[model samples]
Target: MATFDEINVDISVVLGSSEMPVHQLLRMGRGAVIDLDVREDEDVSIYANNTLVAKGQVVLLGERVGISITEVLMRSPEIRPMRTDGPL
Candidate 1:
Protein backbone atom coordinates (compact mmCIF):
# COMPACT_ATOMS: atom_id res chain seq x y z
CA MET A 1 0.00 0.00 0.00
CA ALA A 2 1.27 3.42 -0.87
CA THR A 3 0.83 6.15 1.72
CA PHE A 4 0.52 9.87 0.99
CA ASP A 5 4.19 10.22 1.97
CA GLU A 6 5.17 7.61 -0.61
CA ILE A 7 3.50 9.23 -3.59
CA ASN A 8 4.78 11.69 -6.13
CA VAL A 9 2.21 13.12 -8.54
CA ASP A 10 2.35 15.86 -11.10
CA ILE A 11 -0.07 18.71 -10.36
CA SER A 12 -1.00 21.72 -12.47
CA VAL A 13 -2.26 25.25 -11.97
CA VAL A 14 -4.97 26.18 -14.47
CA LEU A 15 -5.92 29.71 -15.31
CA GLY A 16 -9.60 30.42 -14.66
CA SER A 17 -11.87 32.51 -16.78
CA SER A 18 -13.20 35.68 -15.26
CA GLU A 19 -16.00 38.21 -15.99
CA MET A 20 -18.18 35.43 -17.38
CA PRO A 21 -21.71 35.21 -16.11
CA VAL A 22 -23.04 31.89 -14.87
CA HIS A 23 -26.15 32.10 -17.13
CA GLN A 24 -24.06 32.60 -20.26
CA LEU A 25 -21.65 29.98 -18.97
CA LEU A 26 -24.44 27.42 -19.00
CA ARG A 27 -24.94 28.06 -22.70
CA MET A 28 -21.41 27.17 -23.70
CA GLY A 29 -21.21 24.56 -26.41
CA ARG A 30 -18.52 22.35 -27.82
CA GLY A 31 -15.44 24.07 -29.27
CA ALA A 32 -16.25 27.25 -27.41
CA VAL A 33 -13.27 29.25 -26.26
CA ILE A 34 -13.17 30.08 -22.57
CA ASP A 35 -10.15 32.30 -22.37
CA LEU A 36 -8.00 31.70 -19.34
CA ASP A 37 -6.63 34.57 -17.32
CA VAL A 38 -3.02 33.96 -18.19
CA ARG A 39 -0.54 35.19 -20.69
CA GLU A 40 0.66 33.09 -23.57
CA ASP A 41 4.18 31.63 -23.28
CA GLU A 42 3.99 32.19 -19.56
CA ASP A 43 4.87 29.35 -17.24
CA VAL A 44 1.91 27.60 -15.63
CA SER A 45 2.83 27.01 -11.99
CA ILE A 46 2.28 23.70 -10.22
CA TYR A 47 2.13 23.38 -6.44
CA ALA A 48 1.80 21.11 -3.44
CA ASN A 49 0.29 22.35 -0.17
CA ASN A 50 0.29 25.97 -1.31
CA THR A 51 4.00 25.72 -2.06
CA LEU A 52 5.32 26.07 -5.58
CA VAL A 53 6.79 22.80 -6.76
CA ALA A 54 7.16 23.00 -10.52
CA LYS A 55 6.19 24.58 -13.81
CA GLY A 56 5.03 22.89 -17.00
CA GLN A 57 3.87 23.38 -20.54
CA VAL A 58 0.47 22.21 -21.62
CA VAL A 59 0.35 19.59 -24.35
CA LEU A 60 -2.14 17.46 -26.19
CA LEU A 61 -1.53 13.83 -27.15
CA GLY A 62 -4.03 11.96 -29.30
CA GLU A 63 -7.04 13.72 -27.77
CA ARG A 64 -5.53 13.30 -24.33
CA VAL A 65 -4.07 16.12 -22.18
CA GLY A 66 -0.58 16.27 -20.73
CA ILE A 67 1.91 18.58 -19.09
CA SER A 68 5.62 18.76 -19.70
CA ILE A 69 7.51 19.52 -16.50
CA THR A 70 9.81 22.46 -17.11
CA GLU A 71 11.20 23.35 -13.67
CA VAL A 72 11.23 22.08 -10.10
CA LEU A 73 10.65 24.77 -7.50
CA MET A 74 11.13 22.82 -4.30
CA ARG A 75 11.96 19.29 -3.22
CA SER A 76 11.19 18.71 0.43
CA PRO A 77 12.47 15.86 2.58
CA GLU A 78 10.42 12.74 3.02
CA ILE A 79 8.13 12.31 6.04
CA ARG A 80 7.90 9.16 8.14
CA PRO A 81 5.41 7.91 10.72
CA MET A 82 6.51 7.05 14.24
CA ARG A 83 6.91 3.40 15.16
CA THR A 84 8.52 1.37 17.96
CA ASP A 85 8.97 -2.37 18.40
CA GLY A 86 10.68 -4.36 21.13
CA PRO A 87 11.13 -7.96 22.23
CA LEU A 88 8.39 -9.20 24.59
Candidate 2:
Protein backbone atom coordinates (compact mmCIF):
# COMPACT_ATOMS: atom_id res chain seq x y z
CA MET A 1 0.00 0.00 0.00
CA ALA A 2 1.11 3.50 -0.74
CA THR A 3 1.89 5.69 2.24
CA PHE A 4 -0.39 8.69 2.77
CA ASP A 5 2.41 10.73 4.29
CA GLU A 6 4.54 13.18 2.31
CA ILE A 7 1.55 14.14 0.21
CA ASN A 8 0.93 17.87 -0.13
CA VAL A 9 -2.49 19.34 -0.63
CA ASP A 10 -3.26 22.97 -1.40
CA ILE A 11 -5.72 24.54 1.02
CA SER A 12 -7.63 27.71 0.22
CA VAL A 13 -9.91 29.66 2.53
CA VAL A 14 -12.24 32.11 0.82
CA LEU A 15 -13.58 34.84 3.08
CA GLY A 16 -15.25 36.87 0.38
CA SER A 17 -15.04 38.05 -3.17
CA SER A 18 -15.48 41.24 -5.16
CA GLU A 19 -16.00 42.15 -8.75
CA MET A 20 -14.69 45.26 -10.54
CA PRO A 21 -13.94 46.50 -13.98
CA VAL A 22 -10.55 46.09 -15.59
CA HIS A 23 -9.90 49.81 -15.52
CA GLN A 24 -10.64 50.06 -11.80
CA LEU A 25 -8.55 47.00 -11.07
CA LEU A 26 -5.59 48.37 -13.01
CA ARG A 27 -5.83 51.78 -11.37
CA MET A 28 -5.61 50.45 -7.82
CA GLY A 29 -2.25 50.79 -6.11
CA ARG A 30 -0.87 49.99 -2.65
CA GLY A 31 -3.15 50.27 0.40
CA ALA A 32 -6.20 49.99 -1.82
CA VAL A 33 -9.11 48.12 -0.22
CA ILE A 34 -11.80 46.43 -2.23
CA ASP A 35 -14.94 45.70 -0.30
CA LEU A 36 -16.08 42.07 -0.18
CA ASP A 37 -19.57 40.68 -0.42
CA VAL A 38 -19.47 38.85 2.90
CA ARG A 39 -20.10 40.06 6.43
CA GLU A 40 -17.96 39.43 9.52
CA ASP A 41 -20.21 36.65 10.85
CA GLU A 42 -20.49 34.72 7.61
CA ASP A 43 -18.82 31.36 7.18
CA VAL A 44 -15.92 30.98 4.78
CA SER A 45 -15.54 28.31 2.15
CA ILE A 46 -12.58 25.98 2.45
CA TYR A 47 -11.10 24.29 -0.60
CA ALA A 48 -8.73 21.38 -0.75
CA ASN A 49 -6.81 20.78 -3.94
CA ASN A 50 -9.14 23.21 -5.70
CA THR A 51 -12.20 21.25 -4.56
CA LEU A 52 -14.74 22.58 -2.08
CA VAL A 53 -14.46 20.31 0.92
CA ALA A 54 -15.57 22.21 3.99
CA LYS A 55 -16.76 25.46 5.54
CA GLY A 56 -15.16 27.33 8.43
CA GLN A 57 -15.02 30.58 10.30
CA VAL A 58 -12.13 32.94 10.70
CA VAL A 59 -10.62 32.92 14.18
CA LEU A 60 -8.03 35.03 15.94
CA LEU A 61 -5.75 33.44 18.51
CA GLY A 62 -3.67 36.18 20.11
CA GLU A 63 -1.71 37.76 17.26
CA ARG A 64 -2.11 34.87 14.84
CA VAL A 65 -5.13 33.99 12.74
CA GLY A 66 -6.74 30.60 11.96
CA ILE A 67 -9.82 28.85 10.69
CA SER A 68 -12.33 26.85 12.72
CA ILE A 69 -14.09 24.18 10.72
CA THR A 70 -17.84 24.39 11.05
CA GLU A 71 -18.99 21.81 8.53
CA VAL A 72 -17.67 19.15 6.20
CA LEU A 73 -19.15 18.75 2.73
CA MET A 74 -19.94 15.43 1.15
CA ARG A 75 -20.45 14.89 -2.54
CA SER A 76 -23.67 13.21 -3.55
CA PRO A 77 -23.64 9.95 -5.55
CA GLU A 78 -19.94 9.62 -4.80
CA ILE A 79 -20.30 7.50 -1.72
CA ARG A 80 -19.54 3.85 -2.37
CA PRO A 81 -21.88 1.08 -1.40
CA MET A 82 -21.02 -1.21 1.47
CA ARG A 83 -19.69 -4.67 0.69
CA THR A 84 -22.40 -7.28 0.97
CA ASP A 85 -20.04 -10.20 1.50
CA GLY A 86 -17.80 -8.62 4.07
CA PRO A 87 -18.54 -8.41 7.79
CA LEU A 88 -18.24 -4.70 8.16
Candidate 3:
Protein backbone atom coordinates (compact mmCIF):
# COMPACT_ATOMS: atom_id res chain seq x y z
CA MET A 1 0.00 0.00 0.00
CA ALA A 2 1.15 3.48 -0.78
CA THR A 3 1.74 5.87 2.11
CA PHE A 4 -0.47 8.92 2.37
CA ASP A 5 2.57 11.15 2.69
CA GLU A 6 4.01 9.72 -0.52
CA ILE A 7 0.86 10.40 -2.55
CA ASN A 8 0.71 13.66 -4.47
CA VAL A 9 -2.52 15.37 -5.41
CA ASP A 10 -3.31 18.69 -6.98
CA ILE A 11 -5.83 20.76 -5.03
CA SER A 12 -7.94 23.55 -6.43
CA VAL A 13 -10.33 25.86 -4.61
CA VAL A 14 -13.03 26.94 -7.05
CA LEU A 15 -14.46 30.29 -6.14
CA GLY A 16 -16.94 30.36 -8.98
CA SER A 17 -17.31 29.96 -12.72
CA SER A 18 -19.11 31.63 -15.58
CA GLU A 19 -19.58 31.26 -19.31
CA MET A 20 -19.10 34.16 -21.67
CA PRO A 21 -18.78 34.89 -25.36
CA VAL A 22 -15.33 34.92 -26.87
CA HIS A 23 -15.65 38.59 -27.74
CA GLN A 24 -16.59 39.44 -24.15
CA LEU A 25 -13.71 37.37 -22.80
CA LEU A 26 -11.31 39.08 -25.17
CA ARG A 27 -12.58 42.48 -24.09
CA MET A 28 -11.74 41.88 -20.42
CA GLY A 29 -9.23 44.34 -18.96
CA ARG A 30 -7.62 45.28 -15.70
CA GLY A 31 -10.06 46.14 -12.88
CA ALA A 32 -12.78 44.25 -14.77
CA VAL A 33 -14.76 41.89 -12.55
CA ILE A 34 -16.42 38.82 -13.95
CA ASP A 35 -19.43 37.69 -11.94
CA LEU A 36 -19.28 34.19 -10.59
CA ASP A 37 -22.15 31.78 -9.88
CA VAL A 38 -21.37 31.54 -6.16
CA ARG A 39 -22.78 33.64 -3.41
CA GLU A 40 -20.65 35.54 -0.92
CA ASP A 41 -21.67 33.44 2.08
CA GLU A 42 -21.72 30.07 0.39
CA ASP A 43 -19.16 27.34 0.85
CA VAL A 44 -16.82 26.73 -2.03
CA SER A 45 -16.04 23.38 -3.62
CA ILE A 46 -12.57 21.90 -3.13
CA TYR A 47 -11.17 19.53 -5.72
CA ALA A 48 -8.29 17.08 -5.59
CA ASN A 49 -6.88 16.24 -8.99
CA ASN A 50 -10.07 17.61 -10.56
CA THR A 51 -12.28 15.44 -8.34
CA LEU A 52 -14.54 16.89 -5.67
CA VAL A 53 -13.10 16.02 -2.27
CA ALA A 54 -14.37 18.60 0.19
CA LYS A 55 -16.22 21.87 0.77
CA GLY A 56 -14.79 24.91 2.52
CA GLN A 57 -15.28 28.55 3.25
CA VAL A 58 -12.77 31.28 2.63
CA VAL A 59 -10.92 33.07 5.40
CA LEU A 60 -8.28 35.73 5.67
CA LEU A 61 -5.18 35.57 7.83
CA GLY A 62 -3.78 39.09 7.92
CA GLU A 63 -2.94 39.63 4.23
CA ARG A 64 -3.06 35.99 3.19
CA VAL A 65 -6.21 34.07 2.23
CA GLY A 66 -7.09 30.59 3.38
CA ILE A 67 -9.87 28.04 3.32
CA SER A 68 -11.50 26.44 6.35
CA ILE A 69 -12.87 23.01 5.64
CA THR A 70 -16.57 22.70 6.38
CA GLU A 71 -17.38 19.29 5.03
CA VAL A 72 -15.71 16.33 3.39
CA LEU A 73 -17.16 14.83 0.17
CA MET A 74 -16.66 11.14 -0.12
CA ARG A 75 -16.87 9.23 -3.42
CA SER A 76 -15.65 5.77 -2.53
CA PRO A 77 -18.39 3.25 -1.74
CA GLU A 78 -16.03 1.34 0.51
CA ILE A 79 -16.02 4.24 2.93
CA ARG A 80 -19.76 3.98 3.47
CA PRO A 81 -21.45 1.68 5.94
CA MET A 82 -22.19 -1.81 4.55
CA ARG A 83 -25.43 -3.83 4.76
CA THR A 84 -25.29 -7.41 5.90
CA ASP A 85 -28.43 -9.04 7.36
CA GLY A 86 -30.29 -9.33 4.04
CA PRO A 87 -31.04 -7.59 0.78
CA LEU A 88 -33.93 -5.17 0.60
Model 2 residue pairs with clashes: none
Writing each residue's lDDT as its tens digit, candidate 1 over 1-88 gives 5567888866547543467889988999999888788887777777665667779887779999777889987554554324567643
- How well does model 2 score by local distance difference test? 0.92
Model 1 weakest lDDT span, ten residues long? 74-83
Each candidate structure's TM-score, on Cα atoms with residue i matched to residue i, is 0.51, 0.81, 0.78
TM-score of 3: 0.78
44-80 in candidate 2: lDDT tens per residue? 9999888888999999999999999999998776653
lDDT of 1 at 64: 94
Which runs in model 1 stand beyond 4 Å of their true positions? 1-10, 15-17, 49-51, 60-64, 75-88
Error of 3 at 12 (Å): 0.4
For candidate 3, write residues 12-67 as lDDT tens digits.
99999999999999999999999999898999999988888999999999999999
| Clashes by residue pair, model 3 | none
Relative to the true structure, candidate 1 has a C-alpha RMSD (angstroms) of 6.3
Query: What are the lDDT figures for the candidates, one per model?
Result: 0.72, 0.92, 0.92
Clashing residue pair totals per candidate (backbone < 3 A)? 0, 0, 0
Candidate 3: regions farther than 4 A off: 1-4, 78-88
Worst 10 residues of 3 by lDDT: 73-82
In model 2, how many backbone clashes occur? 0
Better of 1 and 2 by TM-score: 2
